[model samples]
Target: MSVTAVIRKNSYFDSVSLMSISTKANGIDGVDQAFVAMATEMNKAVLENLGLLSDELKAATTSDLMIVVVPSEGADGDELVPLVEELLVRKAPAAGSAEVSHRTIASALEEDADINLAVIAVNGAFAAREARKALDAGLNVMMFSDNVAVEDEIALKNLAHDNGLLMMGPDCGTAILNGVALCFGNAVRPGTVGIVAASGTGSQEVSVQVHALGGGVSQLIGTGGRDLSAEVGGVMMIDGIRALAADPGTEVIVLVSKPPAAETEAKVLAEVANAGKPVVVYFIGGSRDAVLAAGGHFAASSADAARQAVELSSAAASAPETLDAGQVDAVLARLTPEQVNVRGLFCGGTLCDESMYALLNDGHEVFSNIQKNPAFQIGAADSSRGHTFLDFGDDEFTNGRPHPMIDPSNRLARIVEEAKDPSVAALVMDFVLGFGAHEDPAGVTLPAIREAQRIAQEDGRHLEIIAYVLGTELDTPGLDAQRKALAGAGVTVTSSSTVTGEFARAIARKGAAA
Candidate 1:
């Protein structure tokens, strides 16, 4: 009998098991055997893990294309009828290898992304296949596309390691590598600080802190959102650190995340202890007890970690230094009345809010997560004339699509446009790149600064572009290159987002020198 399979619309799965295909009276063939085996494996929850389907409850809902897995040649018309019932959609294409299905999706995107960065969105077979292709191309791949087979992730990451590359997530939400902003928001400077984080937001906070201390990142690697799970293990984490240790540019290491299984934590910390660099560690809400036993220094707060990373990155001959809130207050106290409008643009959702939250005293107002959320997908403004904290995720610049990490056109353009605004004196930004981020962010970034300079010079307006970048990740497109690019632009680059905030505050209340 000829069997039919339906492909669902809006589906992100490109790896559908094609099963078998033949005519009637012939019985099962290779395609049939393969399809049946794939179906029998029965791990629908993988959809959720891969970020293909955000929820697990609906993994089995298939519909768009009608695929017929015929048993063999000829067969029976009666069997064909039964199998045909599974078919749907008049626009179906003939079923073939999974590779062909992926190309179909790619053709759809080619019109938009073409061969360049404007490519908008791709779901289903295309996003998956191209995601794999991107990994093969050695780009820092951060897939919100979840539930990928563990084996696939291992293979992807192993291949990346072999090529001296890094892969942040099969479910990685944030990464800052080579001073290029990816999926997350942060305002870090180009400095000696390096980070390998398991939590997306944790690295964001740390990098911001580093920038605040007049420091920056060499690279910031994200190892999926959960690297310490007994099931997920720390394979990527191990590969990431091993790569970082070999990097000549990274002088200091910072590890940040939530606590993991005791064994997993031990495995990660043991490596940190032996990394031969001063490691500043923060596993949020983790037992201080575990850190004490780690034999490495523990940071009680993100701010402390940032300060230490800066001190260590700078080749300080002593313990890291500190700039108290009082010192910060003192810096702010000198600001004149005209410079109260500090504008911050970031990619990390949590870091954006944290900066807003920190700066939000009496008169200060903030706008967190400004870009990705549907409400502000286009643009937004805070009626308040106070300080503003905005998030322009790699995704929010939907000139065509999301993924600010991979494409810098929108943010870079915004940098030039926003510089022209009358009220925008101090501009705050974050640069994150990794195995999962854009290939060479600095290549796209420097020109924007040059243009912003042209506009600033044209108007004779004193514009300050303050930024923090995270570049210390285990990848071939090293973060150091991006960091240096930003520095060469003569912009104020730091390592921590909070310090970037402070720098913005100084610029907003002060002027171009900040």
Candidate 2:
């Protein structure tokens, strides 16, 4: 194998675009692995871990763009640099077309006075400054950049609250405004239900579920993951609630989060009581009684939250989707008595939490990196015990690498690693399709899935892989095609995240009995 590094001095590209370039480069015929990213400290550390860091890479400044490739035998790694450069070339507008690209927020607003919202995706160190400029310009802000100081977030949110404008996030990853999906969201249909969520995947799962149930969303607002923490105090959640309540198009509201701080929860619930519309609350492991007392409906899961919101808006209940009992039995029949553990390698953090909760509620002991109870936490993230569900998008896994959704390499590697264990029987995962996510999530992960199964089969064991594709028909990659591909691979594809968890739980339970 040959390793090559290409460094461009003082070049900068957003992480998302770099991740896309990296994925494309890895798809090259002879490339074993590729890294296309800015030479930041975190990224350099990632290169070191992979043993791909050359002296040139180490000497490159953070401002420099780095493209490193490890090519297979007989593959010329140097020949691939031109192809990477071609992908980096930004496409210009068609001849005679009147498209304009502005370099600054002020320039954009000047070009179009109707622009009311500013989407900021920059380094966290400068994200606050950029957000402040937007808020000062009388525009709503959705900051996709994480790592901004908590104090800066508080100040910016307060400024927006005083101005009666929306401040969506410091690390907000999903939202739908006026029926338009923005930054890591599904193409959901518009209707009477509105959502204010502090969790990204939780919002996608709920909104997609609503669409599947003959209901649609009026709006899906994101209040970055930390909005409900004691420090942030649910400022944006309260703002989102008021906005949705006042929206004539929104008749039923849904709130998604992983349990807010006590005082923060009270503040948010107080707003819910005054929403004057039906509100469905799902807080992972929150109290149902508190929601009931607040005149809100408590949801048991993300899917349940969607169902309640849809039923409230449409006044019609759809029959619940059921797990295929015969299929479950067939999968169980193939499993050996010694192979009794379920390992979930997920790209979506909220989906991981929801699945863990499902297994725990089913009287199964679940260990996870995100588990709050110390008893259920794993000593080492690299190994699994009993039923384990991991959120690969967590900070530990993503500090230097892109999210697993953006780049499935880490999760794909973990799948093969877990399959090597003789005790593993089933694998659960999620394929999140939408804007700003992987272009072909299911298609890209298929090879790894097949490889993992092959290893188990060669060892006289059967591995069952269950997955849920969280998307809609209108998504860019299209949900049907992704599902079809996975099903064709002999993998069990469930209808929803909750159902995926339930299905895995059943398989694990059956394995335990055997």
The candidate maximizing lDDT is 2
lDDT of each: 0.55, 0.88
Global Cα lDDT for candidate 1: 0.55
| Highest-TM-score candidate | 2
RMSD of each: 16.1, 2.0
Q: Which segments of model 2 are wrong by more than 4 Å?
A: 54-56, 315-317, 375-381, 511-514
- Report the lDDT tens digits of candidate 1 across residue range 1-514: 3443333443332221121111111132223311211111122333223232222224344323222233445544344434443322124565773332234434534544433211112332234455567655445455654446666666666776676656666656656666766654454556677888876766766775566456778888888755776766776787777767877878888877655667887787778766788777776545566666766568755677777777767643233333245644554554443344566666554455445544543234444444323543324333323455655552233221234554544466667766666555566777766544556666767788788868866776555666666555344365566677777887766655545555554444343333
The CA root-mean-square deviation of candidate 2, after full C-alpha superposition on the true structure, stands at: 2.0
Superposed on all Cα atoms, model 1 deviates from the true structure by an RMSD in Å of 16.1
Task: Give, for candidate 2, the lowest lDDT window spanning 10 residues.
Answer: 314-323
